[model samples]
Target: MIALDSIIGTLNLDDEQKFITYLQKKNKRKDAKNIDLFKLLSKSTLDSKAICNQLYQTKNSNAYHALRKRLFQSLIDFTANKNLEDENSIDMQIIKYILASRTFLIQKNYQVAYKILDKAEYLADENLLYPILNEIYHTKIQYAPNYPKINLEDLIRKQKENQNKHQLEDQLNIVYAKLKTVLNSISHESKIINFEIELNDILKSTDIELNESLSFKSLYQILAIANISALVTNRYYEIESFVLKSYEILKRKKETNKQLYYQIYISYIIANTLFRNKKFTSSLNYLKEMEDLMLLKKGVYFKEFILKKTLVEALNHNYTDNQDKAISLAETILKKKHNDIESLLDLHLSLLMFYFQKGQLLKAKSVLSKFYHTDQWYIEKASIDWVIKKNVAEILLYIELESDALLISRLRSFKRSYSNYLKQIGQTRILKFLNLAEKIYKNHNYLTSKTFKTDVEEAFERNTANKEDIFVISFYAWLKQKINKGDLYKTTLKLIQKQ
Candidate 1:
């Protein structure tokens, strides 16, 4: 049986009271069992036995369960009805208008039916609800024989225009879907290397023409595909042209549901592009713009944008040497609820890194403890790159703790888990760094030796030159500080300030 608390939690206080009142009115009983059950389950802590005893005068599990099922069904019905009344769907409005027109037509109320049809047509055309417009056109034609005032030629012309728009929308959606799917599947190094070529191939195969008259949805899709491609291919500079074009289109378009969504998405893309290009201040500005746009229209996709904005802001603060701000933002994100497991894992990893960088060993350890408990779940749910990052973070944490035994054990386990995989992904430099760190930790006597220091410095130089490992967290910088006998936090802060 579903938990009573869970069902109650899905609703607001207003909705709960409405449901309770609905049940009371429907039952017309002085003491309705379902209403009583709802009140009891609404409590923070629910004791099924006590509820059963109070309601049935006996502690009966079967009776309590039966009442719960009835209450759950009633809640579902109430919610469903409420949702239907609260829906703001343009397509639904079109259907309602069309059905009303049909009813009026059946009663031979030609004037009222035509007026309703006119409203439906206007709503459909305004929203570009082409599929529903097709239905509207069919209804128009069906009633045309009954009313000669309905011009068949005009209706046919409108149908053709809508059909062409629908086709264009379909093509754009297909290209967008393919680009997203392929981009998501690009985990291997080889795929990343050839990402641009693959993206071009997808665009070519889709045969979508990018012209000035392109619809807002098409333009947004183009920007989205380009943004993702630039991100994965490390070509941040390529995104500016697309961003400019999208902005130009958005400026020309009037405010609509599609325009609002496109604006939010484009703002996010601009922020991400600036972030990737190391323009942290500018990126934060764009992020604020995105947040403002998001606030203007809190759509169903609001939480996704919120998470993205939060993560980017945290990263910007972290990279700008604002550790306190970074730590605060990341911690706030960890507290917020998220539906996606991968996002939660990413936030946890980011929070752990922030605490470690700030020298908050206790907070870092607390985050690490949580990470370890959830590591297996993450590994099962996330990408290989995510797993690699987590392993590297764990190794770094162990090193910081200065527990040689645990560090050694972790190093060995990391190698066994990822050494071969790193080589496959052209990240052998990471493996080399891990091996070097393991050797230094094992031979504690040589940690301060000139020879060991030179070796560490040389390894850092090699890894730094690779550039591929630059994005894989700055283990090289950590090694550099270790060899130079400088504080990791101070050294990192100095480097960030220079950036």
Candidate 2:
């Protein structure tokens, strides 16, 4: 026992090291089984992320990246190999690819993502690729359909092809110009215009089938080729009568894949025209229908645009009373920014009017705080949106019997600042905004109402008389009329007369 203890305690460093080396050598000699066990890890773990992490942690970079790639390959292989009961199961690979592409897009590695997405797209024969492909196409469509590298051989061939394309394009263009020329041509009779005559013949014979037989690209070429198009030249009833024929035929013929999409744009255009004419209710209904059919989140070009549309729709849907969803939707927009100066200002002023009318001063103050973020918020940048809030506030202020001094002062000061900005921009015509606001603030029911009504008659009367004015004028004229008949105008008149 004494001899053993002394040997252990007083062992030399070399002996101790030699002893450890002997043990390590013995341990290293025998583990084909453990290597086999490690090999089995490829089957043991199906979690792609976990496998990737483990591989990296174990100093296997090549294996880690390989496994990462195999995850996608595995999904596609599974979809291909397995006899799946669910279509969604087959689409799992597509989902993975799309999500991965989005991740790369979010990382701003566009080329890599685009290449990967293209591969994914080729693998996919489904229509789900349309939205993705459309986005990818748009990223470069302005400069060229496909670019960054154009084949010299193809370029030479295309230049030769372009010679023929130019001839065809030029002929279509000449015909198209003839249609445009008809709009400026003075005509009192609906059935007697030169443009209408040409348009009638085209409508009678040409259709998707006839156009196809002539090797033309559907409505696009015919729309391009017609010497005189009726859309611009005809006024409300006449244009509607012509357009409705096409619209009815299109609606009844059983829609193709993209027909619904065309309808969405058409509805949007019609809604825009109606909104221009101050047909807010009609516009709201049209927009609601279009939105119901739109691509939802997938179609949102930007967060701001979508939010603004939703906010306006929410506002436009209700009359006399403000909806709570407008505020919530606005708040949703605000959370995406570091206060979101533009949206906050819009929401603030909207509430300032809505809450002030409802007599909820506290709520109005809370809403106005959102607009305080911008040091110099420019209304021109947000012209149409700013107009809605400012005008609405003026309407409320004019009508409210219990108008707060602070609120009136702030709104009036804003109007003044906006007027100066308008002057500076050499858009003195926009000074009408101040004039309208003044009437609203002063509760000039008759004057504002008169202006508003005339605005509508000008904007909405279908340009039957060939009088084309802008949307703002029509919008303002309509609002003025509303104020005159509104309870606000009545209340204001009572107060003014008493004074």
Candidate 3:
């Protein structure tokens, strides 16, 4: 059986109440302890042993395990029945139509069966649900002899075409999985790898194209791959045209709500990409579009995308010289419990930057303290890139705080931990940055020298395209602030504006 407590933990207050009522109606015995077991599990504070003792007046592993099994089965049933009851779910509606069609066919009602199949087929086709359409086509061909007007050859041809589409979808699914693996594995690495080229090579091998003929799901997967690539390689500018084109095709498709999840996510990708590429105003405009889409179906996906929406909004606002607004947005989200651990970590680090730039050293140090988890925990939960950013930020904060010993300690720890990884990822600039930061911490006079400023500028690449990643610029702003004796926020904005 599934982990009973894990599933229980996912239920909200209303879901828990509905589940309790469901159990009440289904309970055959007044002595049944399944509801009590569920309630204890939902609380998630008691262990299995403690729960068993309370339920059985002793340590009864067998009884507790049996009750847990029953609860898991009930959750399975309730969730399945809930899906069937969701009128907004097109997949469930198609399944209902297909099952009804099958029932009518078994009852020898050929006219009704054909009508139901047609409805199922229309819905499936509109949603690009090729697998379901294949099943519907199979049922139709099986009963084709009962209806003289049924086009047998046409049905077979359609099935073949659908099989091709489904095969392509399966290929894209593998590509999506591969992209996710690469993203999770190499997010910490620098520009040593040409991830976009590697992904393009894979797509070329499969002959996949971002075109109108591809289904909504396929386009979404392709866009998702591009988004991951952009995130990995920091090349959001390169994928803007392709993402926009795929979005246009997504809009032209029928039954948009059927793929609402994809639509919402694709909009997020666009907005985030625009933000990364320094198109702040356009990014906010698309964020508005994304919010409108989130309001559909009674805001089913609002909670899911809230962190992402807020993150992008804050980043835009932060870069646009609205540091107070950015900090407020991030702080508001941080107060809530969100599953987006990565985003939360990001917000914490962003808050550090915001407060640091505003010359609020104490607040910046407070934000730094919130990163209480170990480096390994952060690397697993977020990314090594994030941990690196956090470490660099902490070192900078310590420097500003004039904690010489702590600054030296953090500088040494950072180098000892990431020096090899930086070399492995061809990020020698970061190592050089650590050296410069250490030098400044040791003397404090070298940071303002013309020679040190030239060395700093030479250490980092001045991209001809002048479109450095925002986080990269954020980290460099500390150095720039020292070099020019200027405002941190102004230095960051000037650096980006120079690009």
TM-scores for all candidates: the values are 0.77, 0.36, 0.89
Off by over 4 Å in 1: 1-87, 107-111, 141-157, 175-204, 212-244, 256-262, 297-304, 336-340, 372-376, 380-382, 444-473, 487-490, 493-499
How would you encode candidate 3's per-residue C-alpha lDDT over 90-208 as one tens digit per residue?
88888999999999999999999999999999999977888899999999999998899899999999999999899999999998997777777776432245676678767776877
Which residue pairs overlap in candidate 2's backbone? 449-480, 452-477, 452-478
Backbone clashes per model, in order? 0, 3, 0
lDDT per residue for candidate 1 within 1-499, as digits (tens), equals 7676876866656667798789977896676688878887786364777778888898778978887888888888887777666434666788999999999999988889989999998887766677888988988888888998889999999888888878888888887888776766654222334566667777786666666556666677888888777655556666766676666665675644554566677787788777766678989999998888787644444665777788778878887878789888878777755655666777787787777777777787788787655444555576556767777877878877887787777777778866775675456777877776776766777777887777765655443321222243356667667776787767765544444
Model 3 stretches astray by more than 4 angstroms: 1-5, 24-58, 86-88, 188-197
- If both were scored by lDDT, which would come out higher, candidate 2 or candidate 3? 3
* Model 1 Cα shift for residue 412 (angstroms): 3.3
RMSD of 3: 3.0
lDDT of 3: 0.83
Q: How far off is model 1, as Cα RMSD? A: 4.9
Candidates 1 and 3, the one with greater TM-score: 3
lDDT of 2 by residue, 1-499 (tens): 1122222233234433443443344344452122222233323543434544554556565665554343334334433443243323425665576678677766766667667655655544233233343443333232233335424465345344434444444454455555544433422111134555665554453223322112122233443332123233212323333332443454454333343334555555445444433345776887776676565435432232444455455444323133455555555555543223444455556546445534465666566544443323333334333543455454344444445575466556656645554454334444554455445556656454666556544433333222232223323433434544445323322322222
Candidate 1 — worst ten consecutive residues by lDDT sum? Answer: 464-473
Quick one: best lDDT, which candidate?
Answer: 3
In angstroms, the error of model 2 at 469 is 11
* lDDT for 161 (candidate 2): 44
